[model samples]
Target: MADTDDVINTGDLFQDPDGFYEPEKEPTFAEHRMRSGDTVRGDLLWNAGRTSAHYIEERAAELIQGKDVLEIGAAAGVPSVVSAIKGARVTVMTDYPDPDLVDNMRFNAGLSAAMIPANSTLHVDGYKWGNSVEPLLAYLPPNSAGFDVLIMADVVYSHREHPNLIKTMQQTLKKTREAVALVIFTPYEPWLLPKTEKFFPLAEENGFQVTKMFEKLMDAVLFENDQGDEKLRRTVFGYEIRWAEDQLK
Candidate 1:
């Protein structure tokens, strides 16, 4: 419920003069894009941000075109923007639903509207993991099946939210064979990887099939002072999740 001004201050807390972490200069995602007049939100940059954007533009461009896409925990919503620009049938960018977060997403969407295809529609909504899907479902085309693709990047850091995240995916993703949820994450707390990896098994037990897509290591660390394992912090994991064949019944 915090206002946009409060969120701007929240973003400022990430910046430290001692160089412990490199915080993007812009205060918020919307402000950065509007000022730069760029489709990408460089101020809210993450290693996964660039990787996922590239994959969508270079590798998944064809697959994403004309597909219903939903992105969760999309702070900057860069990947979703990329998918929309690449021609998704419809794209919805959602996050914690805070007034500021949701409004910022809308601001970003508004500025990037021209890049989206005329036939493609982009929406912004406030959504919480494991919450009711009814509101989100209402946004889908009246006769549509379900979202064709789900995008989650750098969202697995919170160990407690894994189950809720999976549940949201289950309720929103299409059961079709080709529909998938792209779960990409980096273990900022490298030593906690084993705990983070538990999400895959949890997903399988909940009627989803998980496939490992790739492991990418970043060239730089987001936090220089955190004593977490370097390799784990820098390595990013990409997984493809789909409804288990039997679960469709």
Candidate 2:
């Protein structure tokens, strides 16, 4: 036998490799207080969604009141809740068909039920972009053309889904001049902003006209230590998409 100092040392034989095992992480949430003073919680409460909610509250008479409204990727469903409160005839809030996400949206909707106008309705559902929109359309009044306004907050970040998003818009947006889709997002990963902006030109190519609405700077960045320009990360960009006159004909 060799001396103790010359003995080879072997680590735990049953130990897994460094990256071979990762424990499931607990879900995290972002909490926000709506204008009504009620707090809402979600896996994400993106600033872009808050900006869109403010815009809807500000322009309810023209954009939401008495209109059919749909919010895609409605993580927290704040804008949809506000629309119902503002008197939208029908407000449908949807997100990825994960049980937790859908349940969260429904919970938020239920929390604000008292604030919603008695004559108006707010519904929540799970949806995937580019999928059949028949279920969504069925929520509208019988013989209805389509939704009058579509709220899409913080969704363009998924560059790969741009076409699918536009496809959903084409299927759900009313053909009338008043129909519009609101697209809002922040460059969380500032370096990839160009990719996010590409959604507009793609929308135009899909027979829609794009209009820049506003750029808002929040008090603080969403990801404090995230890379790239903090200003860009803190800024929320807004746009409106509508069927081109030629396309509407």
Candidate 3:
């Protein structure tokens, strides 16, 4: 964790759970280390349960090369920065309203941008779920239909936010380009399947066809049964959805 002095040159520097500097305290999410690339400098909340999973990142960059991109639920901007670093025309890092991640994302974006050539532009931003695209519209041309690429990761943690996530994806995806939303989840309860279906159906209604691109295993240790014997049946899976152009029909 980078301190208020912006200089934590010693070992075992921790941000107290209440705050980064609340007199003497402890680091909440195990040990602290300054990471490289776009900085996305927030606290343990965003860092917790966060990973730059290969399946998600590889698919996102696969969709984003030579394209304009928007990454929703971009907790720490890892995918967004990767797209920018890969030469996407532009990449916007967006997430739910949280001051800590927002500032951290900006710092991270700056860190990434500094290393890039002079001709590229990669932007970082904050967005509220279920809102109109007014702020996001500034980047895309009017009636452009959709962005060249749209990506998300680990955003399927809830059943309620699924519809809103679909709506946001529809609003941001172009009619021609393959709009990809990668949701990797560890099924805590079976309820997620029905809720996921509810949200996924909206893609076709919004004039796009969706497909399951791929699936891979992930470590799932969060949800345990009453017995608490490491919950043998649960596993995390990654999904890639390719949203096709409505007009192609």
Candidate 4:
């Protein structure tokens, strides 16, 4: 594993390159019978308030209850925290190790501590995609097969980290045929929707199967002022990924 210090700062400079300076603020989202607030700093606000997040929040009982979840590039960890609140056996929320990003995730987790189910637990950590999974898997409960679900929201916007994201999914997701990864994203740059979507093919090549779950036209324009395909900015794509039958461990 690369030293955490040596890991490139992809979580900021690359993962969410479009994010820019904004005055410090606290943003909140309500979903899954839960509400969470985040301390916003330098990181892009990709937490559960977004349309993709709404999808997860709406399906919490079906997807999160009694499961183990791991969320990658979780800017404010809304889905992870919400999953824990909805009764996930365990929810690990991770982002880049940058003090600010990690600290903000912790703050958001704290915001919902009172709502976490008695049978569930929530943990926060800084994780660079494609890094060793041992550290993350270590958080699994004793005798757990692996994470029952993996959540990747908005992180797929970065064209360069596709493989790293897939690699992390392979290493951390449970091998059971039923285990799945929820990939939800919007092509903020409408013109680059094709490139942003290539991540699915790459995942198929790496022993996973991707199924289109839904496409939602969000009420809010993700990049209202950005110059891109307007239709793409307002649409959110959702997918369910699982190990191919032949690749199941």
Mind giving the per-residue lDDT tens digits that candidate 4 earns over 1-249?
Answer: 222224323343234344432332343343333324532122345432354455666677877888899999888787777677778888999998999989888987887798776899999999999888888988998887689999888788767787678778877889888899989887766676776788888788777899999887767764446666776677778899998988754
Tens-digit lDDT string for candidate 3 (6-53): 221223221124432223122123221223333333332222224433
Worst 10 residues of 1 by lDDT: 1-10
Question: What are the models' TM-scores?
Answer: 0.82, 0.86, 0.66, 0.81
- Clashing residue pairs in candidate 1 are none
Q: Cα lDDT of all candidates, in order?
A: 0.75, 0.83, 0.54, 0.74
**Candidate 3 deviant stretches above 4 angstroms:** 1-53, 56-62, 141-144, 188-194, 219-235, 244-249
Scored against the true structure, residue 28 in model 1 reaches a CA lDDT of 26
Per-residue alpha-carbon lDDT of model 1 for 1-249, expressed as tens digits?
112122112233223356443343342222223222454554455666666766777755556998999999887788888888778988888999799888877876776778777888888999988788888888788988789999998777666677678778877898899899988887776666776787788778777899999999888766676577898778878988998898777
The CA-based lDDT of model 3 is what? 0.54
Q: What's the CA error at residue 96 for candidate 1, in Å?
A: 0.3
- In model 2, the number of clashes is 0
**Total clashes in model 4, counting residue pairs 3 or more apart in sequence or in different chains:** 0
Task: Show model 1 residue runs off by greater than 4 Å.
Answer: 1-39
Best first by lDDT, ranked: 2, 1, 4, 3
Candidate 4's TM-score = 0.81
